[model samples]
Target: HNKRVAIDLTLPEHLPVLYADFKQLRQVLYNCFANSEEVMSDGGKITICAQELAGERLELRLTDTGPGVADDDLKLIFKKFFTTKKKGIGLGLPVCRQIVRAHNGSITLKNNPGGGASIILRLPLRPLITIGHGRRTNRAA
Candidate 1:
């Protein structure tokens, strides 16, 4: 890829650990980064900031230097099969929301004052140890 993009990760020195599937969480991050990169076609800086919320939550913010999405499209961005890109089949943000929810988290998008789009993902500080539905046992002994 010859595209020039800058990514800045602004995270706490000692980040708290969460129990989650490495692959799934990776996909979530990947989608966000890819989305930001796609919007900034001509090379722009993407800032990733993370903070610990007051209510035992983790907030991850991905900000890009591309023109922000229209206000009308903000609400529809996370909707399945919705996209502003020419080749985008849409599913990216929708899947991101779903994945965040699975981790008992949330995702939101808004426009930055200067320009560009800011997407925030808030996740629980204490996540479930396992990622599957608990095993059901027949206790009728």
Candidate 2:
């Protein structure tokens, strides 16, 4: 859309690395930013904050300044083929959720009390790596 979208990134210098599929994770972030851009056609701000949660997981909050999502649509946002945009096929969020789940993470969306919407993603810092006999182990990468 050629919109001027400003990104506000907040992350600690010593933040731990997450163990995940690089390509899939990048796609998730890209899809989120694309969604924000599509809603803010004129221009807007996207605030992204990343932090460690009790040394167990990483929490990433992506808040957009575009018009917030509707209450009724919130439940259906992650459902396949559910979209509010005229040109959107509604696979973005569903795919994002799927990718996140594949990494043993979770993705959620909620409207900001002030305005716009926020997408919260939580991923384990040490993703479980399965071994023989269904044994699992955590190794941060």
Task: Estimate, for each residue in 1-141, the C-alpha lDDT of model 2 and write its tens digit.
Answer: 444988889989999988889999999999998999889988999999999999998999999999999999998999999999999899999999999988888999999989999999999988778889987777655
- TM-score for every candidate vs. truth? 0.86, 0.92
The global Cα lDDT (0 to 1) of model 2 is: 0.92
Q: What are the runs in model 2 whose C-alpha is more than 4 Å off?
A: 1-3, 132-141
Per-candidate RMSD, Å = 5.4, 1.9
| Candidate 1 segments exceeding 4 Å error | 1-3, 129-141
lDDT of each: 0.83, 0.92
Which stretch of 10 consecutive residues in model 2 shows the poorest summed lDDT?
132-141
- Tens-digit lDDT string for candidate 1 (15-128): 776666778879988998888888777899998999888747788999999888998999799989998989989998899889888887899999999999888988877754
> Which one is best on lDDT?
2
